[model samples]
Target: MKKNVLLILLFFCLTDAFAQIDIKRTTKDNDLKLSALPYYNYGKGLGITSPDSIFQFNIRFRIQNRATYMQEEGEEAAIDGQVRRLRLRFDGYVGDPRFIYAIQLSFAPGDVGEIKEGENLNIIRDAVIFYRPNKHWNIGFGQTKLPGNRQRVNSSGGLQLTDRTINNAKFNIDRDFGFQVHNQNEHPDKFSYNFRTAITTGEGRNSTDKPDNGLAYTGKVELYPFGSFTKDGAFFEGDLKRETTPKLMVSGAYQYNNKARRTGGQLGDDLFEKKDMKTTFLDAMMKYNGWAAMAAYMKRSAHDPITFNPNDATDIKYIFTGSGFDYQLSYLFPSNYEIIGRFSTQKVNRDIAALAPDTKEYSIGVTKYVWEHAFKAQMEFTLDDMTYLDNTSKQNWYIRFQVEMGI
Candidate 1:
């Protein structure tokens, strides 16, 4: 049974790592004079402090193991391996530090998705809560990710490929249940900005039953032009801090989803009517010295993007209205070894192009990072190229390997 639920989740993660090493050795051998927490580092994980410092915790976990092979053009050649992401995270601050919080969980059955018929195993990817009222705003509420695209808000353990693309798996809006507002600013060496917005529950992420009266609005903007890239590094993906002056970021986003009932609005399936979705995104990123680049563009729309089934007329369901593009580049070698490249394309919407097709892809990757994306290893290759609606075309190939680790 999934190896006894992975040995009871590895015996509660080794009994919480031996009860956090006996509470940090009994608070330093009984000196008990609290206020010292913050020791175990290595990518900043394992910390817990609450002796009146008003609650703070941080525990992290990550895993990703993957393998794959494929080939097609008349099929037959496939291979696979799994556990592609096992996550477990928690971050904290509660009575103050501007009240932050976060939680994440997923135990890999492809990170807990695909169990429907009234849902139940989506495994909560992030729970969110934040306020951060200073140094440039931030306000958030439950469930995360949906500033949409920049590789779907980056961080699939920081990528540089072994995943993501196919125009972010076909038009990425990927998470919901929100309320967010954010802002950022800078002018230090000149130029930086960010803005974000959200309002959600367009059904996704534990969406407890409200099948209609849709919501999901979103907005985003960002600009950087020459500032910001060192620590935030344009939100991770091969550059590993090598920016010695020359950085950039640009972003744009929009979403609507009023009346959306899925088919990829907040993520696929569950639609036999309701449509009104709209999406758009644009992106850019750059870095220097050790090079990096990115590009994106996406589009979605629905006015009558097909969804019929009033007692089935062959059971209809379309709404992957489409448009996509992606591009990437990478470099990184100062021994942290990286090399990546990507390209993607998409185009559905000839009224769903007879249920989707028209693709193009290409990828190549290599990574090693070892500790830069909290430990990594990757390999990728892809080719794809499809086209259909009876115009016929095909091609495929893939290969992958992965490994990732986190604090």
Candidate 2:
């Protein structure tokens, strides 16, 4: 009953906000026209614009369906199929071009993950408001992706393969509720640069309570020595545009989570005791003509890895402290078909190697882009090898196919 009431109130609040836009214009002496109905475009989604141009909104949704088959050495093959992702996104300027808002919601079970009691449903992926006072500066508040690794910051829909590498799953700072400041500038025919910083709650997104008085701080900077890529290609995987000139971007980021309660800092299960965690990331991306390449290195550490339960010393959990490397190469053909290859390796600290073993993965994939990333089909094959703490080794082979479409 309470949830229903809250939903009703939210609906009314949104209706009122939309109505207030016209009400304010009616009281003024400015010329105002009726807003047009929503219209759809191929990649831009459905958009609605106010006659006075004071407000604009765009609604977009994407769905990803995937099937996977995997076999371990001396084990039976396993097959799985599911809706990998079902996401709805809304973004636009609220009152003026400088004031922008973005909201994204996830519906697929895999996208929502495991929801704990007393916490949110974990469906809200991003809900951020931005103040772009100028072309070079943007200030944002609310839940969003942190200033982390390049691949982690990139939208999942823009990947060249089926998904990200193991390095990202192990070391990337995914997202959190935070305040971010970003700045970007470019010198014509020379170079470009971007700087971003954030301060956030140490807990990951959708947490109902704060486990401790801790926070996370992150800062990142990127430099492009050969000018910027065509159409913000730095943020997405692959080089679909086939840049006429060579483009390269190098980035570095550092994050410190003071007294974080989660095992993975902003991710993983809750730890019995809080610990300070620090992470560093270095990465670079290069694109020339139809070819693109990327490489990243990540390392993380904690003051103390293991945490023991206060009442029961036998129960324990440890932070994953380790290093990882990921590399990728891809080429986009004029026919809108692309081929990609990737190699990734991760090594956990010996103390936690039992829980998170050393791993290496090799993957190759092909993607057919009907309309760039918005409408695409992907197929990938991967070989995964892991070394356990006991010196035992295991290997697996995986084959996956996925289809993604939006707008």
Candidate 3:
């Protein structure tokens, strides 16, 4: 009985000592007045703030796992699994809050692909400096995503579907070295306007030298006729916030690339010959009461046909003369479940109609947002049908399952 009492007393004494240390640490932390960090995954990331509020740093990491099954008509099926993305990001401000910067890196082997020996690593996803002088004006420079397509601009971590559409895979502006100017004005009566423009090196990212000494110009304008989305909600899918008021945005963009080297502008392999090209984008988004809808149209035209094997005179892979239309709709339930549907079509220009085939795709998916976009599982199946002018048709299908989690 005496030994038992002694043990209990010893336990209490150790607890008290630890408690005092914790109290001292908490008191010191409180005295510094550090600001709380912000992240989609609550309390998952790290942040540090200086005592004087002149500097801040935030770090985050995210990963995506994916599995896919693909089959072509009259062919064997293929199953694959891989780590789709492994990314680390850093974002903060230097002396002033208005002057901010961000650096993002991807370490996935698939993303890095096969690199040649003796070449420097080029895994920088985003490295940009931003200056938001006021609520109405902002300027940025460095390598970053170009404001092009709605789906492409949306972060992959926040998608309601398993993956992006084929149209995005074929014709997204991706990223480039550039300088951008943007502005937005919101009215007191639930209306807003936004404008953006950029001048970028026509070459894609990580290019040490410019091939043609030409630049690309891009501009976009948007109007929110039914008030702006809350917390930039339009960037994410499935109306998670369930806004009480309807929110709508309509935007249009135009781009001109002078002597573009690549077939897909800022992405894809270099063309056999450089050519000038023009691209147009139109999109609309609506969100109301957990219901969301989006539609986009994209068109690209080149000044002349691009041929890989000039002697054969049968190549048109780098022409980049086509149009695509995409539409999507989704509804989020109170239980954090979502159902989504999408349709997309692509048509080659008449000049290359015989060499290229038209494609139409249909897809449907479901997502369980266990913790909003920060943690979710998604599945989607897509049917792709291709048609030739000669009445020949081919069909292919693919199913994908993905899980995403991030801090």
Which stretches in model 1 have alpha-carbon errors above 4 Å? 1-50, 57-90, 96-100, 103-127, 130-140, 143-155, 158-161, 165-168, 171-173, 179-199, 203-213, 216-303, 306-350, 354-356, 359-373, 388-407
- By summed lDDT, which 10 consecutive residues of candidate 2 come out lowest? 33-42
Model 1 deviation from native, Cα RMSD in Å:
22.6
TM-score of 2: 0.89
Leading candidate by lDDT: 2
RMSD vs true structure, all candidates: 22.6, 8.7, 7.2
Clashing pairs in 2: none
Per-residue CA lDDT of model 1 for 39-122, tens digit only, reads 333447887766566777888898989889888889799899998889989998888989898999898888786766666888
Worst 10 residues of 3 by lDDT: 33-42
Clashes of each: 1, 0, 0
**Per-model lDDT:** 0.83, 0.89, 0.84
Ranking by lDDT: 2, 3, 1
TM-score of 1: 0.34
How many times do residue backbones clash in model 3? 0
Top-TM-score candidate index: 2
Error of 2 at 267 (Å): 1.1
Supply the global lDDT for candidate 2: 0.89
